[model samples]
Target chain A: MNIKPLGDRVVIKKIEVEEKTKGGIVLPNSAKEQPQMAEVLAVGPAIANDEKRKDEIKVGDKVIFSKYAGTEVKLDGEEYTILKLNDILAVVE
Target chain B: MNIKPLGDRVVIKKIEVEEKTKGGIVLPNSAKEQPQMAEVLAVGPAIANDEKRKDEIKVGDKVIFSKYAGTEVKLDGEEYTILKLNDILAVVE
Candidate 1:
């Protein structure tokens, strides 16, 4: 990807929601809700340094973000959401 | 009026969507899209300190947030959304 987020923005790759349960009942696409979680791919320089900002999030973190948040953009044929640092709700443990 | 969000969370009071334009064509409540913006009221302790977190938001700042981002709750008969710092998209200039 040729995009680098500026300031405290980040690039997130969506994580797919489950299509089935433990009982093995398959679910249609409409039956599933989009996952509100994503993996952090690239983080901006403003948040990468502890001196500039309290860096709680990092690349490769499995994070939960707000639904309907961030602007979606296509990069190299893959979809990504560009979000400010505050758009991420939590860092999943 | 009596809510305080925890961690990186914040309390947002919704800014109602414009029901009419200057041309005076009034819009019904159903016709208006929910405004994706709000005013910052109460901020969490974790986000108040610069050493703890870089505070980009403050009380009374007009902010734009994701419409479906935060958890909604009723406080004192008014609706408010409690959101993490990341859920806030930007502070309006």
Candidate 2:
């Protein structure tokens, strides 16, 4: 099932990093490194201010989020995170 | 100078993890682990959601944050990240 967050929360599908090094060395799960990127699946409506402002991100945007930004959730056999709009560092176009 | 975020940004002081192991083993910087903790330093005003609601965190609180949630900015003699409030997972009282 798809889990969507309410309010300013966002749902992001994590991009898995390669388990092998450039030199063809294999890495264990414990040794796996965190990636600096992710794909945006959904964003919550802007946290209501005086008015609802448009959020800077949209669906399918590839983004760079802080290394520590969203709550983790497992969905549809994959892992995803629900982050607040502020947790997003930069939208990678 | 402190780099306070202008909007829903929060300033966090990274908690340096121990470079040693249970057996007194030494870990290199490259082999260093990311800590699941940080201390809150400052928080920006709520992004005007109709009215400013009180934030869930405050200064000096130790917190658990998403492993990928903020922008890294080096201020003064230390490194800190400015995350959106949503990036914060749970505060350690």
Q: Pick the candidate with the highest DockQ.
A: 2
Q: What is the lDDT of residue B3 in candidate 1?
A: 78
In candidate 1, the residue pairs with backbone N, CA or C atoms under 3 Å apart (3 or more residues apart, or in different chains) clash, namely A86-B85, A86-B86, A86-B87, A87-B86
Which portions of model 1 miss their true places by more than 4 Å?
A: A1-7, A10-69, A72-93, B21-24, B50-54
- lDDT values for all models: 0.76, 0.70
Model 2 CAPRI quality: incorrect
Instruction: Flag regions of model 2 displaced more than 4 Å.
Output: A47-55, B1-93
The A-chain TM-scores of all the candidates are 0.81, 0.78
In candidate 2 the C-alpha lDDT for residue A30 amounts to 68
Error of 2 at B15 (Å): 26
lDDT of 1 by residue, A1-92 (tens): 34555448888899987678678998876677877989998886568764755568888999999897877754346777779888899999
Question: DockQ score of candidate 2?
Answer: 0.06
For every prediction, compared with the true complex, DockQ reads 0.03, 0.06
User: For candidate 2, lDDT tens digit of each residue in B56-86?
Assistant: 6678989999886777753334777778787
| Candidate 1 local lDDT, B15-59, one digit each (tens) | 876667678999876778777658888999887764534446678
